[model samples]
Target chain A: MASSIHDLARHLNISIGTVSRALNGRADVNADTRQRVLEAARTLNYSPNQSGRSLRQGATHSIAFMLQPHPGDQQYGEPFFIPFLIGLQAKLAESGLDLIVVMGAPGDYQQERLRRVVETRRADAVVLAWTRREDERIDYLTQAGFPFATLGRSRSGAKSYPSLDLDFEKAGADAVDRLVARGHRRIAAIRPSLNLNFAYLFLDGYRKALRRHGIEVDPELIASGFINEAGGYEVTPHVMRSKDPPTAIIFNNDAMALGGCKALAEMGIRPGHDMAVTVIVDTPLCRYFSPALTAFRPALEPMGQRLAEMLLASIPAFAGPQGPRIMREVWPLELVARDSD
Target chain B: MASSIHDLARHLNISIGTVSRALNGRADVNADTRQRVLEAARTLNYSPNQSGRSLRQGATHSIAFMLQPHPGDQQYGEPFFIPFLIGLQAKLAESGLDLIVVMGAPGDYQQERLRRVVETRRADAVVLAWTRREDERIDYLTQAGFPFATLGRSRSGAKSYPSLDLDFEKAGADAVDRLVARGHRRIAAIRPSLNLNFAYLFLDGYRKALRRHGIEVDPELIASGFINEAGGYEVTPHVMRSKDPPTAIIFNNDAMALGGCKALAEMGIRPGHDMAVTVIVDTPLCRYFSPALTAFRPALEPMGQRLAEMLLASIPAFAGPQGPRIMREVWPLELVARDSD
Candidate 1:
């Protein structure tokens, strides 16, 4: 179980260089010697170290998924990644590839982290999440000619790359249309303060939906919060304090919505009955809430599996017989209605 | 930014073998030649690939953490790991080492995963969680002479190893004592059906505490769940249907407790008023739940940091001036009294 190449050479009573050449299948090594070396290696359970093998093959046989750091010392924004990672890992396993999660360092070191992973040849490909509108990391990976796939779409890299993005824009507009149909005129949206590509896309659809209804989009009705429960708790009252507060509100995530609901309960405003609420749910938190939340649920596990497949398609070694195809897909979401809205 | 060793050698008008020898500081290479190669490598922005360098040094300079898979196809049990991972990555970064999360495959493939990580030299050390009583994984690592640290204590392996464990035994007893003080006699416990070491330790403490008060242990009062919300929701009524039902219940985790609370509400029973409730909290879920839950909070982020420190202390390369020391510690939990109990 703990045998090495040196041990193999010693046990076979052969020169170290001869054993290496025989194992590496060099033309100079005799066939009989190669067979003997292989048999001994199998018997000794001598698994070649990945470092030595990767050096010769120039492939790590591992894919890295960058876990983006949130603002400050906060935890990653969503619990959805746990299932997503499981799915990604399962798919990668089919190709005999290992999935390594590379955590982004705090603050602006994210780009540096990506560069190190690429420059050091730690992985053959990478999967990026928490994409920004103008992601320098994407641009860096693209210009460096490193293989990568993204969880969200970005408008940064010059060359198109494989990406699996949620239909966030459609979800946003649908939320607005649903509220408008329920006889709500003033609608509010709570999004992350960060300049994420999805947040911008969501607002685009929300504003467009308002215009389609001939309703004016008010600046006061749009609020930005940190992407956490406390952020939602703190911003709920601020948005409610507007001169003419919105009767209906849509939160960017379930965690924030949970906090907003708690804040509303303390303010004596009952959700569903008094103030209509909707959330972009990724976890079961909304399902078990006191008043089950109306949510747009994305099938995260399947999406994660697709993300891995798309990434593999872009890597020439893992691609199909037709060769590598850089794909771009917008995953669909299902709207589940509950008492909250 | 994408310079390779071949490009450097071609630019310097030297043989590739000569350049390699100079960079690796071989005795055969002259000092002047080595100095010239180093300066040219820096000027070209050439970063040595980790595979080649690690083969020579016998070190990957990376740590692998095993994210234990839960039962069936369920997501990893808790979201508390997000902050915990962030803490670990930050601490590892201090030593110029990277943290790579290795996801355990479904079913009984965990030991195989650990073996691959070690045999392939993918990481210099490992961090294991979801420890079981007499865990074979621990025994395997200890026997293989691999550096590792556990998040929970285990009664496995011939030699001692570094571990940072929670005081689950005390927490279980404290919960019972607190309930007893509040005039409760029949207390039910909901633990994971899995044979986790913590669950066993927790139940041991619970049983001892009930006996301390001269109360006989009732088999009907103990319940087992799948470590998720649905598991909690499903088992709540079953435990309540006992011939002589318990007046109070303690859930192993917050997600299950949240589901149990919902189930109680549907049955016309309020958590704090009709039945006392307590949870071993790892996330912010219980704090924001209606009738805020009584919980024991472990400082997860700092605990993660400490776990990293302990693991590094065991690795000779990362150890302090005094050399590697195998440390074992039990982390304390703070009981937060909420409205639920």
Candidate 2:
């Protein structure tokens, strides 16, 4: 938010470069002039864009990770990002790239923060996480031709972008198949909010699995909310209290599943025995849960490493891509079957 | 990372200001020179420091948050940082200070990473979170006379620095008092690794409370670990199997408490019924725990806000301090009693 270096220079009645040298305290600048420049800078409240100066020389040697809340969700306690970030940074460090995290508020959703960063050229290559289906950010980045990558894929028309995401549809189908094999007729499902593209994609696979087994889809059995502990707690009772309560449940994440277990315990219901439960994405804490969770553990560190590699490779100087290499990666889900399902 | 623009100017047979002007793409610079300068910069792989140019001006208008793994502990899933960071960034935003997060690895512990940042002048003022006692970073920053703040207080001598931390010792005593009042004769405590100042401070309060209650402190009842869910699971069984088992348990954090409860559940032990449980901090998930946890809630957002405020106020230009104003704050913890303990 530097008003203008030109204005500061004009006020000092000096050439812009002399003003720069004076403010920068370069050996060539006079000491008295440097002091005058500092006083003027303080008076003007001068603040230069750090990245602007770096980008002028062609590279910043830094990867920008702009952290933003997922649209329509203020899910605060999802412990996924930190480990993912740590992994990404470790990978980047080998190439002498620093990872600078720029955080954004819920109000600054939809790549509005990223747009500013790109304009300022704060980082050479930007990395976006938790992509949505039909993401506008993906479209904007592709159109602008900015070097960037995402942890999840976006449904953009024919434009190739570097991205990595889970094969959630397959994971969803696998979960349903496993629950059905356990002799469960009535099944309940808790999905992430419908706004996220993954939620619907997951449900689509779930529906196909039910169809394969010739089970009619029951609209009453489906519940949707934020995929956290509270979401599971609230949805469990509604689904269980239905006219035909399901004997089995599938949670979108371990957080919701854990919450479901607590709800079941409160109602004197035993999971895996009274009500079969399955969760996607196993967390370390899940192992300590009673009636141990049947879930999928996505290799986060590897994913992070892969994402960084893909992003680095996509940079024109790195791999010398031909007409923008897609660098697509859809990781398969790994199942860890515990007693819960 | 930038291999010097001065060398580039000498190599190109141009004045330093001309190289700067050309690299920055000022209108006065010739187009041919700008192209030649860009090609040379690419060949040299010169990456300018974003803050270096600003740092010369006496301020970067940036506040750095160096994210490091707590020493001797690779605790990854502490959901505290994101919310705490969000709050700090929000507070800093009002003062026109951009938050730059520089993450560090366990191997780069001590003040190694921070030393590099300081040498680079990456930020005007730095913020350290989750500080340890006898912290080398604190000592170095204090000795260097750098502007900085800590989320937790350090055990440094009379020379004070800006800091805000939870009064864990008081919370530990309060927890013991509550459990003792609930007719628990033998109570257990799970502290963070003794290497951390908090563990001993909390234990100090615990011992004081037990003594106040006229009960003998059983050394076997006190345990320590990484302070995550796994820590609680590992220590719960050992303490429960002791000759004089504890009727009540006070876990350092909710994650450990949840794990402790799970450990009990595995052994057919019901928390609040068979073993009273109290956690030091209340997490959102604690509300759903059956025989719910009694915990102390440290207002984190406000704490972040306060830390930022204190750090900002300590900046000499902002507050015109006589010397370095050593702002210190020890936040009061609020008790949230549920079914457990």
Candidate 3:
């Protein structure tokens, strides 16, 4: 594990800087060279000393995943983050990169912790998950010259950065199409916070799907913001109270759906039979819920793999000619049929 | 954020080495000195450079959580870790220690990962969660002289380390008493793999509870096993096939119970009516499951906080006089009664 870059370069027939660069994911190196360097390092048991390597290449072979836990985290039963974490860790484990989950203190969250992680050079790269549409972390990471990848897309629309996201737009449209096919015309949708880029995509999918069915997008029918349990719980009551309440409701996640169900039960409504409910991100618990929840399951492992690969390839000191490329890998959710709409 | 140890020492009227020792969690520094040193550093916005400081003090203000992705992790719906993480993270955030989750690759689980994490100095302290009867990780961590803590107890009889565990024995005994009170003389229990230290504790609890009722221990009624959904699925049938099947059953977790329920339903058994069922570790999904699951619910926040506090205190650099102490905290689970029991 102490084998140096010199030994690695000598064994691989490459220059020391190239070895260091390849190890660090630098763009100047090429893909094949980086591969050889990595293979050689592994064969020789050369896990770099993070301290010394950081001084030379500004790399720590570690990435931090930051999360902001609101009250809704528990209400939703912590569904999204766990699978997402499993996917990310599974991919990064192959490259011997460690993942640090940085949870903020009461007052500070992602942006604050990110600054600490980057400014202190604690990691070779940073991964931003669940990005807001105008994410401050994206801008900070970019301006700070740290290689980063977001599980969600940035609003900047830069082609240089790496990002991997779910095909929410397709899932949203498919959900609407499925519900519409079931003879439900008045369909309503719930979305994540409007500030989140994915929420925009979710809304876009809903609009596009409705348009495909020759229905005009109704602003009143869409409930956005913190689309968590509280969000679902709060929004459903309003939707049900509307003069023309929709018979069918689409939820972004099972938590929201669960919350919505509670609201429905309060109003003497049976979710699947009286008011159709469909959700995205089918958690395992959804199967146990009364009127088993029907949801669209995204390919989490692939998404996590793509993000890890992009982040690994983007490290400036270790990247090859196949340098950090702006990659957008989106997997559409597969519908998992259950008792619920 | 980049204030060096020298600047901190100068500002706080301390020696450079003292400042370094204080920041690095060294035991040599007195409690008062360490406190003053930490306060001054914070006031001056001194965020230590992990690389340089690590070279000098052999420490990194970070901790790693190792996870083995067993099939049961997904089946249990991963209810425990998330809340545990929230608790751990919330506490550690105050001390500015980051939590690194190390997911083991297929073949090499904990022991191998610990060697690398410690040898590489990736973390100043390594946290071993879910201990076994004679945990290899615990021995290694102790031998390596690396500051460490565990989320479970060790069987070594030597309480030299910090641990915070749930009172599984109490939970198990409680389940038995509750079932016995419900007029069930024949009871069955599904335990975790006996190799796990907690499993033994869980079994002990079950035995003690039965003894409380003056019932002789029935070896055939206790299932020592790989107690996941599959284990439950496979074991329940055998129990039922026995010449004298148990009228009441206790499960280690919701996952195993859910599996047992499936096995029961397959045999046209009506749980909670035909046979009583009780489980530990109540999860959010259990509520929606038909005939809501009755299980023991531990206060996860307190458990996590204890672990984080212990790990934080164990750090050699920042630990004050009230420094890292070997403490054991065991919280009894609060029973949530439901239809299942």
Candidate 4:
């Protein structure tokens, strides 16, 4: 059996606390004592109980991230997750908080999982990436009185939770405006699932842009699909086969844009030549594509950092607000015109 | 301030233990009493210190996952992560262990993070993915006496660790055999970093297969790149433009295969017709590609399940060798013939 802290304490004829401090690399432990304990532990192959120590320390210094279930096998092409993680990690690095990612089923009672994290003290706080309408996870966290911040907002109201999200509607509108400015009258919008609040918001922005341009919104030009490459690829054939196909297609995300590019290639249609494609979420891969993809920049790193800060602050009691605090920050989507658009 | 367990105890006129039991849904507490305690806690918006409870229980019922850093943007088009995650989650669901994933930069001492989890009691055991040659993480875990199982084997051997891994060499050799059987002598192998143990093994398999078929191993045909889609795409133009490009190209992974497919499409060289492409790790998206991808099955789900079970068993004292206990299981990589090859 591996030696425990108690066994080490006995072997060294020292208190368990002193041995623990040495093992934990605590500053209080004398160098000689620390070395002794370390040497002994090295020989005995001792593994201490970390959870117990964290409880005594009053902080786990860890953040929990729960992933929403991906419905299909389609890989989401966007590198949004990496930037978001980088941003979160950048901030957490300062405070010595490590990110602990968790993948949960879509229909799974995520609230229970969140509660468990808090109940077990596995994390000091949680950062929720995917937000849904009437999010029970948010509500349960709120009701259970745990601190958390979401990447997206709930449709019900901003008063209910703290979230950091791009003005998706504005982003969608910007895409349409960019297409219209390029002298493309008939533009199609590929939106994400309607289940998400941002999906509806983006659609509204598209409609608003069309109305401002005095161009009637064509329902046939709008299609909803998963925010992935395949989603974009699958819908391309449908749009191109249409009798009055739009000259420009705006995608909800970059993954779909990749698919859209592939579809155009298949149909012997050059995206920037025969048809224009603008994708939201400017990722590094966009620049590497054959023609280089045109996309909107959300600056995900900053967004992730802001969200982490908001969640950290929201954990303590707020003196000003009775309802849940709402902090809204809208980043301008810079249209990086590449060959595809 | 949010109500605490003590506050709930005061409000319900019950002991802290009773309140805790009720909150934890322990069967020992009377259902009626549990309901009343729960109701009072809910009304007060009580949230107990989860860390403290976890320490007391001596189990966090969570699993820790650690990944080694890769060169370039960590979020490159690597389809392996998502599927591996899905498989891990599927096993976790059955075992009721919440997964806590941590990504660390290469050469970073992850032992501190592992210690923190154990000391804080945030997790019962750890599942280490993507093991490398001479992995310090494995040594640290073994010396520290923490329970952990690896996704891939370490150079030291499996006697010190339990691992679920593919017969990378066999997979590589089989690809060559298949291509050779199809009357192809000139072949190119797109390899990942040769520094990696698995990559070297795969190259060895490739060499062995070529030798059996009396074909000399051409160093010029072996292009080393990152195992990602963009890497595949980036290499395509160069490979296609080469004066003596092979008729068949075998990718290290599926993401790269897709990139190769896209590149072939761009060059007006139809995959499966003009150039054969084969990738490792089969998934549903392979079938949807323009020329559906021919690939190897990694059996990720079963591997995850087995790893979880092994880790769980190792948590307690096991009478065995003191050095690394290595266990390697090779799942057959069934070839799925598709349009791509």
Model 4 chain B lowest lDDT segment of ten: B317-326
* TM-score to true structure, per model: 0.90, 0.82, 0.79, 0.82
Candidate 3 per-residue lDDT, tens place, A191-269, comes to: 7677767767877898898999998777667775455656667787877766788888888867677667767876888
Residue by residue across B165-212, what tens digits does model 1's lDDT show? Answer: 899998999899999999999899988864788888889888999999
lDDT of 2 at B152: 81
**Each candidate: chain B TM-score:** 0.88, 0.81, 0.83, 0.80
Listed for each candidate, the true contacts retained, as a fraction, are 0.56, 0.38, 0.23, 0.31
lDDT measured at residue B313 in model 1 versus the true structure, 0 to 100: 88
lDDT of 4 by residue, A231-293 (tens): 777886776666788899888776667677677777788778988888777765565455667
Q: Higher DockQ: candidate 1 or 4?
A: 1
Q: Ranking under TM-score, best-scoring first? A: 1, 2, 4, 3
Candidate 2 has a TM-score of: 0.82
lDDT of 1 by residue, A221-248 (tens): 8888877777777788888999998899
Which whole-number lDDT from 0 to 100 does residue B284 have in model 3?
59
As a whole number from 0 to 100, the lDDT of residue B276 in candidate 1 is: 96
Mark the regions of model 2 whose C-alpha exceeds 4 Å error after superposition: A1-56, A70-75, A320-324, B1-56, B70-75, B320-324
Q: Which stretches of candidate 3 lie above 4 Å from their native place? A: A1-49, A74-87, A93-96, A156-159, A186-192, A214-247, A259-276, A288-292, B1-48, B71-77, B215-248, B258-276, B287-292, B312-318, B322-324
Model 4 residue B90 lDDT?
A: 68
> Which structure among the candidates has the greatest DockQ?
1
- Give stretches of model 4 more than 4 Å off: A1-50, A53-58, A73-79, A119-121, A157-162, A237-241, A258-270, A284-291, A317-326, B1-50, B75-79, B105-121, B233-243, B258-270, B283-288, B317-327
In angstroms, give how far residue B312 of model 3 lies from its true place: 4.6
| Tens digits of lDDT, candidate 4, B1-341 | 54578888888898989998888788899999999998998788676665565566666667778644466545552345665666676677676667777755333546665666554445667887666667777787777566778877677533666777778889989999999999888788876676566777778888899999999887778877766667777776666665677899888766666666667767878778988888766764465455567888777666666766565555553323453344567666778888777
Q: Measured against the native two-chain assembly using Cα atoms, what DockQ does each of the candidate structures obtain, in the order listed? A: 0.54, 0.20, 0.28, 0.31
Give the C-alpha miss distance for residue B150 in model 1, angstroms. Answer: 0.5
